[model samples]
Target: MTPPPPPNLLHDAFSADFEHELRFTRSVLDSSNPLLEDLLGWDEQGPRPGLIAVVDSGLHDATPGLSKAIEARFADPALPELRETIIVPGGETAKNDSNVVESVLSAIDLNRIDRRSLVAVFGGGAVIDAVGFAASTAHRGVRLVRFASTVLAQLDAAIGVKNGINRFGKKNFVGCFDVPVAVICDEAMLETLSDRDWRSGYSEAVKIACLKDAPFFDLIEKNADRIRERDIDASRPVIHRCAELHLHHITRGGDPFERAEARPLDFGHWAAHRLESITDFETTHGEAVSIGIALDTMYSHLAGRIERSQADRVVEVLRRLGLPVHHSALHGEAILNGIEEFREHLGGRLTITLLDDIGRPVDAHEVDPEVIARAADLLA
Candidate 1:
């Protein structure tokens, strides 16, 4: 494998910084197999070095196929030892599934593997999140790679090195930052997604557009039909673009590893995270986030924090994406209680990303309870 063009010269320079000393890359799964070569810096050396572990939710066939693909690529007997490969299953349930993480870690032996070994997470956001958190904690740290199979994973969860697992009924209550050595985005993997999964993932893509780029929002509007139909050709660019947007916000400024000064871009996450915990992991993260975005926008409008038009627009886009915009399943009281829980989860003082206008965010330190009540009323 030829050495990856010097890190500083890559097209996505921002990614270089996100990975720290680690490397990052994205490619269509069925396309060329340069990722292994690039990652290992192996030319004619036969097999690349590294213990590869593949984590999948087992809900889809893509995960096993991904592992097979990696194995096939490095099958040459003359190459360096490819080390052992472990496959673990569990999806959203795995986010809080410590047993699965422990199983993966035990297979790799935390004390045995070093930075040279690689933990390749090849599944949806939940699987990636679980394995990533495990890898970050194992042996202090090790090389990590993510092959985000779901749209939500690719667009939002997988890029950031924020590895975490749920605990005490709270989402991401345990975790650390362990950026992947590289990322392989196989758009083909998306074909295996259920319609519900697709819609859930698209909700996140919509959030990114609503918070950062109007043109991106417009693109989604225009291609909504094709995207919903699962048009790989049309959806690939959209997925890549959304991931780029997330990467931009995460590495914008300040320390990438530390969670400090919540940006307005984290708009709905405050409620979204809590809702997930309250629902006992029943609600999809994207579904919770969709409701959170709508509720947050409603709060912004009722508080005179943003225009009613802006709130309506947010609802429109979310509805168009086939996402839930109402908190009807959750009572106003529950939502309020959830808000308090969310704040406590964040150690008090909720940080919300409110829109001054569409695509414009302002960090709000203290959110009024009255505003939350009004927002809940609107959703109800």
Candidate 2:
């Protein structure tokens, strides 16, 4: 046995520091607001960095003169030079199309966007994700500033380090993690959202409240009507709290990149992702999440992880908020594919989060299809 000749190896280890900034304000596009200006300000003495703006096509349609406003604002002397203003497909369409990513990349190449430059994305979550993916990969990551244009974007979707486009019939199959320079939640942009779009965001609030803060759940329960009615005053605190909770978990949850077997943030996501794929994304992420939450809660009860009363409270709150708690597809076996995809996505043995009680989450390594069938029936 030739004593394994002198092992040649050198170990390397280093930590990369990151900072996440989230700001909340109203009327962000107005010149007097100074929010956008502050975000992209360039000192007179330093080499000016360029900026390219990407707006969601859906949001552009809703807000007339939005492109003009963005161009006019970034034209200021103190802000980064506005190189181009591009509009991409919005909602899930942004993620579904490879052309959308290519479009943004073309603009980046044509305009010479660089590492020192910035990409300002003004849109809903899907558009943001698609554009963010483009910017992050361009020259190995560019600074990104997000102008969250929907309730869902402001409170949950845009408040993370993920930028992705879906492929191979899986949600976010292709993506990258780049901490954003800033995530701005402007009240004016959300006001442009339709009623259905508005209510879609609160389901995320319900999700965070269920796994982290029971008191927050009470607040949402109390304001479900006002939120559903599109009253920003009643919905503001819930949105902020949800955003903060998500940020907190990302920074302090010990598994920011999900390298562990426990994923508390994805409590109801397994079914939600499946529902979206089956429905061809017509179900809407928020509606699917509402149903997913209720389904998981029902499953938790059936599996003896949570009491019936707790599960009922979870479903009732979603209903009061005017969100769906059931869909016919979930009643079939096709949904089981989500579990396998989820396991593959996480790159290990299956791990799913289930509720033991409000504000308390437990991880289950093995899921019972029988219990899922029973839960689907109960939901029906």
Candidate 3:
């Protein structure tokens, strides 16, 4: 055999260092609050940065004069001049429409939004995701300031550095990861949410509490009734703690981009994502997550990873929080297809996060379909 000709080889490897500080605070858009000024950081020597605002259409309707509010709030000399206030569809519908994202991009280009300019997205999680995706891809990436207007956005979705839109009936199929300059959780904005939207936000808190903090779970359990009553005093601390936990996991979890096979933070998400698709998204994400958590908790018990009592407690908390623990879609084959889709999304291995106890999560490579069926039956 002819010796393999001297292998012409060229290898190049280098590390690109990345460091970005994200400000997470409250009351950023409040007229009396001074944090927006600090966030803008005016310098007399430099030109003022321009800003383009994107408000959720639903929010605009609820607040009536929302555009006026944004313009007035950013009127300070230290703050960026409001160039345009664009309204986009809200909720999951916002993400479902590509036109919404394109409209924002068109606005960005037409207004000459640059890297120095800021894209302030004011809406719920879905609107934030759609607008942020546009902002991240526009001019490579422009500074983004998120005004988290709902419980879900404040505590979970808007806290992370990922953005996407669904495609081919899959959740977040097209996306990029770009950290926002700041995420301002305005507690006042959440007041306008319907009762269902309000309760929908707590499922994420329950999810994190189950995986990372038993004490936090206990706190939520204690406050579930008051939270269901729409008591902000009881809900504020939960939102804050949950947001902190998510930030810690993103920064300290060592894989900010999900470059690893094991995704501990995605507990209960496999079924949740699939359920959303199977149901044609008739079920909201938070409600689906609550049901997914219930199913996974049951599976964990059946698989002998967690005690039946532990599973019961999880289901109880979800019920107390007014979250649904069972859905008709959970029993369908399309829902089971989510397991493989989730594995494909993660790539290489099938790693699923399941709880062995409160505040402690364990990863499993395989799940028995029979057991999953039984768990669904029990949930049903």
Give the per-residue lDDT digits (tens) of candidate 3, residues 275-358: 988888888899989998999999999998888988898999899999999998777777889999899889899999998998
User: Which model scores highest in lDDT?
Assistant: 2
Q: How close is candidate 1 to the true structure, as a TM-score?
A: 0.85
Candidate lDDT values, in order = 0.70, 0.89, 0.89
Clashing pairs in 2: none
Q: Which stretches in model 1 have alpha-carbon errors above 4 Å?
A: 1-32, 43-48, 59-67, 77-80, 110-112, 344-348
Q: For residues 1-380, what per-residue lDDT tens digits would candidate 1 score against the true structure?
A: 98877666545334344442222344433336555555545455433455665657553454456656556655643323445566666566777767878877886684366656677677888888888877888778777777777778878888876878888776778888766777666666776777878888877777777788888878887887787777877677788888887776666645566456464445687777767766766778898888888887887787677799767878877787777876554554555565555566556476767777677767777677777767777776
Query: Against the true structure, what is each candidate's TM-score?
Result: 0.85, 0.97, 0.95
Model 3 residue 300 CA deviation (Å) reads 0.4
Compared with the true structure, what per-residue lDDT tens digits does model 2 show for residues 1-380?
A: 66777768878999887788899998777789887767667777978888899999989999999999988887777888899998888899999999999998889899888888898999998998999999899888988999999988988899978989999888999998889999999888887788888888888899999999999999999989898898878999998999999998888887677678777777889999999999999989888999999999999999988899889989999998999999999878899999998899888889998999989988889889989989999988
Off by over 4 Å in 2: 1-6
The backbone clash count of each candidate, in order, is 6, 0, 0
Highest TM-score scorer:
2
Error of 1 at 123 (Å): 0.8
RMSD of each: 8.7, 2.1, 2.9
Could you tell me which 10 consecutive residues in candidate 2 have the lowest summed lDDT?
35-44
For residue 120, give model 1's deviation from the true position in Å.
1.1
